[model samples]
Target: MSATPQPVVRRGLLDEVTDRILAHIRDQGLRPGDRLPSNRALSERFLVATPTLREALRRLEATGAVEMRHGSGVYVRADLSRLIMINPNRLRLDGAALLDLLEARELIEPHLAEAAARNASDAQLDELAANLDRAGRALDEDAALHTANMNFHRTLGRLAGNRALAQVLDSLIDLHDQEQRHILTLYADRDHDHHVHLAILAAVRGRMPVKARRLMTEHLRDVRDVVIRALEA
Candidate 1:
């Protein structure tokens, strides 16, 4: 008798396809504006259904990693500067716009950090610590590090134990990601930034609410200065 054929394991369709495509692009070192294979071709190659492929592509597009043209094809979109949305109706960027947002963050985030230091439970602190570790690792890389750092900030907000505050912080962070990435690209040194983050973490871990508050306020101020200087130059 002939040996039985092996059964192939099917992964989670949409998520797996999305991840695989993203990984392929990264591993292949595909540049921004590189055209992706057609939907039908990609679907055939990946053995995923057309709908699943479409969903995967949609996710990429939503994340500012890909762009689709009606008469053209999908092109990689890697301009993080253009990714930030300050005003929906405006097509231009002004320094004031970024400063305004950062000012708001300075007003809210330091107090939130203080509150988190005061109220965070052991489990919550542990989670925040773990996320910070990941952020430290990613800081050496370019795009990936920024994404991870963004996630770290979002989680930090959540750990503050205020749902409303967390939601607002998340929205602001999301809106600022593009501009943040742009500014950081100029002056960001992973090692230095990581040390600053470590300092903030230490204060938080020590449960010195006032110290943590002050440290984070300083950190934001430094960030604003760096960003403004870069923009001015």
Candidate 2:
């Protein structure tokens, strides 16, 4: 009889270990509030050292996955989505920090657009096309247009193929969007935004990296001016 082959084993980081453990529970059809194996048992089960297992458990607790008791071992509490989102207002950002964030974006994003122009596949370009269509439809509605535009930029960031850069840009953009929504309350000028965005999109579509870079720079400049003018007025 043929023996069953062992699966290839891989070592994972703390966060990945936590994700894997949670995934195991889900795949096994474990119910909510199900008890995970004890730390020592889990370590043995996964063939990981106890310290690494402990680190994973700590992250799960912080993220509100499992609850600890004085005597009882850790048990799954609930899903992570139950954790509240942060209120932007409560986040402390000083003027210098805000400037730094903006400058960082300026440095990172222009090149990202350039890279997207150079490297994005036809499928990815189609995604951008879809986003632009949504933006065009939302043009008359400033808030909706703003959302579409935000998504378009985020899609471009993703096309840059750098996960860490994209994550940082997402966070900064989220913060900026929250602040700008309050400051730029007027509905966006549909006629103007459509043309400007389309021009940028065209450069990207044509694979004109330099032109795409220029268009992106101009678009950001216009946005910065409008936001500053609105704040000052």
Candidate 3:
């Protein structure tokens, strides 16, 4: 039998270990609410130190993947949808941090869009359309529109089917989700952003990877400039 592929990291970090543990659960056919092995046993199994294992377990708990009780053991949560969503309270973005965040988005998001164009299934496209539809109707309602906008991008990330990429982008973008209304104000044409999203979705749906990449890059560039303006204001 062919050996399973291993991750290329020299030693797994907390995030890597978190993914591994989740995979282990799935492979073992452990149902939601099933108890995971004890910390000592899990540490030994993963070849990680106790402290490192605890850190990984804590990360999983934060993402709602597992619940850790003070006296009780860990168990998987029934809802994993929370896994892809980031906690806004954990964000501490100042000027420099915001710049770095947007810079990273500019670098990564275009490629993600290209990949989504190549890899997205029909259902993913439908989800994108649904998000866009919701956003379009909520333009007058700032908070709702911003939320729909954020979901739209996150859905795009999922469409790429790259869990690592989706997780990183979610963390980075969630930093700005709360600030979206302020940043989105920089667009002179209120509906322009929605139109751009549609164009990107059409590119992805049409299997135009290059167009998808270009549109996504331009979208990020616009957003980055707006964020800079907002920070300066």
Candidate 4:
């Protein structure tokens, strides 16, 4: 049998244009909050139609790299230097897929919690404490509480001192942010969640790796159980 040749993949013009626009932003040293040229100007510069340029801008806007404001020009909203990016158009996962996501987190996050307990500095521990405090205050406000809770998990991942794992966790968290908020409503015990986070933080701050890992594992399992029940009901 003859060896099979790989199919040649061609990049779309839209992707090319998007890359050019991002390059222009970097080449011009544009930072977050810096305004880019007008749409007409960018279209002319990229030699693409107005619609094509708008589409490209919308793609960037969706990724948090830039913000498109009506009546005002496009402004940089994020650092283009990120190593990992989330899927901008990812749809909500079904019950099975959601369970898979939680399973993946359950495996990875507790290990990260252990790493954080071993390696985190006093400053990092204090920051985690502050985040827990924010979560405590936001217990009655769904949106704020969700943000704070997610931040705690994300921050703990980064404090683990493993860049690759941290980036992976970041993408995972960003991908399922909306679903996590929905999970919060399903779980429906804000005080309990806040206290669980506090307990995890205390373990991390105390430099108790075994305790931190155990607490994190218990917390995630509880969340997974909540989701399973919700699906069952």
Candidate 5:
């Protein structure tokens, strides 16, 4: 006998609103960094209650679609163009899961670094240099340094010219963001991390693919070791 068909799941209003908001963004040709309409304006446009609209905006914010800045309004972000993304409602990763995440990064990011060395343009190299400079300046500030470090990895992944792997890396980065920051606090060697980044940037800037790959592998291994110690302690 044939099995019965499963019931179809209906879409929620919030999901519908999220889709509409995305459509609105595309229809208006809004690019990254462009400002969106105000919450009141959006609520009116969507014909939804203020609370419902706010919830929809929150959903979009979680996926990196928009940044809602207090006293500054909402603006677009680059992730809006990404084809794949992490689930915003994912549970916090446990210690084992966190290590697995790092292992995945170690496997993927070194290849990206090598590719960046092979394919990155002069302008992209300059951007990596500027990122390292910012990281140097933020060495004493944990939050700033963390943001700079994450940006360097993200930018390097994109410079590899592999959109599919880049997007996967992006999702991995976002997935472990909280755990990574916590690990940074425990690792507590900002200078060492910064110096390693400088070395990787040098290899990439010099267009030395083998050197870049080796440096990235060493860098991630160091990070993984720190995380392992943190988990044990």
Candidate 6:
């Protein structure tokens, strides 16, 4: 169970509340199965309206971070759904399954890119551009480069400005990341991934929605081919 969380200093957004809750978990060394304080207590502690706190917890639940047990209480969870939307560790990530995932990406991501091109703020685009540079510098080195690559995609999701679509994509991407853990830890085609992201970002930055969609489609295709070859070899 978690210790008492610190009093929230002032009002904040749902994301801020989520971050603070996560920080508290890390700080308190809360383990899976640890029970959290009651909903009423947390609402008062965070200095937020009950509805906002519930919304933040809902996000956490979506991420597999915490479980709400009716008539029981809330408890920490190991965050399995980062197999999600199932745990990646428990599922068979066979080639057929992987291909299906890529197919979903092919169908969904181009639309996301189009949306991002239409809606992304200048600051968001700039961050993605900077991530491309970071990717170049960290090429194929495991954690650094892989993280930068994922960040670029996550940034794209945030830029799309549709919360439901972004959240669904986030879960799908998280599952893929879990599967890639083994391969990336051993080897990464960071250069190839890096270049593809660069092209995709360029299209988005140029405010060309159709072009962004085309580039994203092609990028996902390349990734699918690469993964297939990796599995075969």
TM-score of each: 0.61, 0.63, 0.66, 0.80, 0.79, 0.63
User: Whole-model Cα lDDT per candidate?
Assistant: 0.78, 0.74, 0.82, 0.87, 0.90, 0.78
True-structure lDDT of candidate 5: 0.90
Global Cα lDDT for candidate 1: 0.78
Q: Which candidate ranks first by TM-score, i.e. highest? A: 4
Model 6 regions more than 4 Å off:
1-90, 184-188
Model 2, range 115-166, lDDT digits (tens) per residue?
8888898899899989999988876676887788888888988787776777
* Candidate 5: tens digits of C-alpha lDDT, residues 162-182: 999999998898988888898
Whole-model alpha-carbon lDDT for candidate 6: 0.78
Q: For residue 179, give model 4's deviation from the true position in Å.
A: 3.3
lDDT of 4 by residue, 1-233 (tens): 87788433234988998999999999999999999999999989988888888888998888778999899889998646577887667677788878888888899999999999999999988998898889888888889999999999999999999988888888778866787788777666888878899999989999999999999999999988888887777
Clashes of each: 0, 0, 0, 0, 0, 4
By summed lDDT, the worst window of 10 consecutive residues in model 2 runs over 79-88
User: What value does the lDDT take at residue 154 in candidate 1?
Assistant: 72
Predicted candidate 6 versus true structure: per-residue lDDT over 45-71, tens digit per residue:
778777778788887887789998889
User: Given candidate 4, what's the lDDT at residue 229?
Assistant: 81
Candidate 3 on 189-224: residue-level lDDT in tens? 558888999999999999999999999999988887
Give RMSD to native, each candidate: 13.2, 11.9, 10.2, 7.4, 6.9, 10.9
lDDT of 5 at 70: 92
Task: Quote the lDDT for 130 in model 3.
Answer: 93
True lDDT of residue 167, candidate 5: 92
Better of 1 and 5 by lDDT: 5
TM-score of 5: 0.79
In candidate 2, stretches whose alpha carbon ends up further than 4 angstroms from where it belongs are 1-99
**Worst 10-residue lDDT window, candidate 5:** 6-15
